[model samples]
Target: MSTSVALAAALAGFALGFSMIVAIGAQNTFVLRQGIRREHVLAVVAICALSDVVLISLSIAGTGFVLGALPWLMTVVRVAGALFLGGYGVLAARRALRREADALSVSGAEPDAASRRRSLLAAIGTCLAVTWLNPHVYLDIAIVGSLANSHGDARWLFGAGIAAASVLWFTTLGFGARMLAPVFARPLAWRILDALIAVLMLTLAVLVLLPLFTGSGS
Candidate 1:
């Protein structure tokens, strides 16, 4: 019965973690693109997956207490995150409009050692920004933390399960993206993707501002 409980907690953790993360959003889009481009794909995946692990672990270890102690912090984060997401949305929209040319440039560019190194660094920086700046991350971590603790002494195992989910998802998304390279080769696909990204980002920005709009800042 004890073994069963631990397995159950781990499975629950995996399911919840995957469900929360398997969404289309700014961070995912950026990661997907990096994967498709094969530009620092490993680094981007590592950063994203490891960041999730750290955040998840911290939350399980009582970051929620810190968040609870400073409830106003989330409000500030929400406002800043909304602004940042909105800005990125606008940038995505612009990219959608010019995707044809951008795709052409991407395809035409030659990858040299120096260029590859620069691309790797740039991709890592972008991945960090995408992962850290999004308010959704904090919310998810808090929720996951709460869920993990629900398992009592099994929460650590649960946390490990969720961390594994992060690793699996990112590894698959980053590497599996190559399989879709043929379809994305068309500039039209890139345009559509960017347009969708723009819409998603803008929608997230609006949702994040709901607290301010409803006069219930949480």
Candidate 2:
């Protein structure tokens, strides 16, 4: 491909990828919470971006065809993801209700090593689950990959652009959230945030399972 065509394809890919991921969802909400808490922010951002790269690459490699051949697999994933999201939503709701448990502290003192390690592990595990378990992610990859492939010889460049978009977006969201630390200092602010997360998560869980129940492959 000529240089102008390649650049255009890459820029198009970046725009599509950024638009797709900028929406508020389970993964974004979790990342926002981790960012605000200042707990494992880099790890969470890495997982989100890296997972996108892997998924996009696999889709470009024709994994979407394999997935299409096994429609039942998507059904299984949808059910599992809905259940997981529902459980998480309940937890967020509980946190919102219990002020003592949901307090957001901005103190400079850090947790001990053991506690920090455990928290880090938990955060990483949750981030992975949120990213991987969502059936919508595969659908997105298929869409993006199909679009990128339309660019002919510039497809790889397009995929690379998508990856770049993921990295840029997650980095901005994870680090920029700290700017709102002052606003989240109050315990009530934490409660409000948790409550919003709870609602969003539960709603997403319902949406994920809706197609299965309604018999519409929306």
Candidate 3:
């Protein structure tokens, strides 16, 4: 690709990746939790970025049409994702309410290191499932990738550029947030983060469910 096209592709990819992921959701929440605990950050980031790569690749390779052909599949995904989001939102809100005095200590938790390690791995697995199992990820990747391909760019190059953006953004988010672990060590800060997470999850659940009710009315 020419320098100008490559630059454009890279910028486009970065913008799309950032925009899609910057929202607060289960995946980002899990990543932030891992960051705070200072464990398995890279592994969690890898799962997220790699999942995006695979989904975006499938989207660019004409799988977008196949997904489009299965409207019921999308409906199934929408319902399942909504339920998951809502359930997670309730848990977050419950955490917000419990609001223990010592909830945010980074170094004081007494679990054995092995147990902590397993918890980190479990968190990573959950993040991967939340990102990969959601149907909207496929819709965004496939639609965006196919649109980029229509611009006559090399297909593999386009997908690679987009995938690179995913890798870069999630890695930064996972690691960069960990850099703030000191600040989050404060119980008050942890409370604020948990409250914020609760609101974000509930807001997203509302966004998901509003369409269903509205569409039914129309």
Worst 10 residues of 1 by lDDT: 99-108
Q: Which stretches of candidate 1 lie over 4 Å from their true place?
A: 104-109
Off by over 4 Å in 3: 1-11, 102-110, 216-218
Q: Per-candidate TM vs. native? A: 0.90, 0.96, 0.84
Question: Which digits, one per residue and each the tens of the lDDT, describe model 3 over residues 54-173?
Answer: 887788777777777776666677777777777777876776677476344645558888897888777766786678656567678567767668757655666676788778778888
lDDT of 2 by residue, 1-218 (tens): 69999999889889988898899999999998888888899999999999999998998888877778888888988998999899999999998999484556755687899998999999999999899999899778678768888988898889988899999999999989888888888889999998999999999999999999899743
TM-score of 2: 0.96
The Cα error of candidate 2 at residue 177, in Å, is: 0.2
Query: Which residue pairs does candidate 2 place in steric collision?
Result: none
Which one is best on lDDT? 2
Alpha carbon lDDT at 159, candidate 3:
67
Query: Once model 1 is optimally superposed onto the true structure by TM-score, how far is the C-alpha of residue 208 displaced, in angstroms?
Result: 1.3
Better candidate by lDDT, 1 or 3:
1
Candidate 2: lDDT over CA atoms? 0.89
Clashes of each: 0, 0, 0
Give me candidate 3's TM-score against the actual structure.
Answer: 0.84
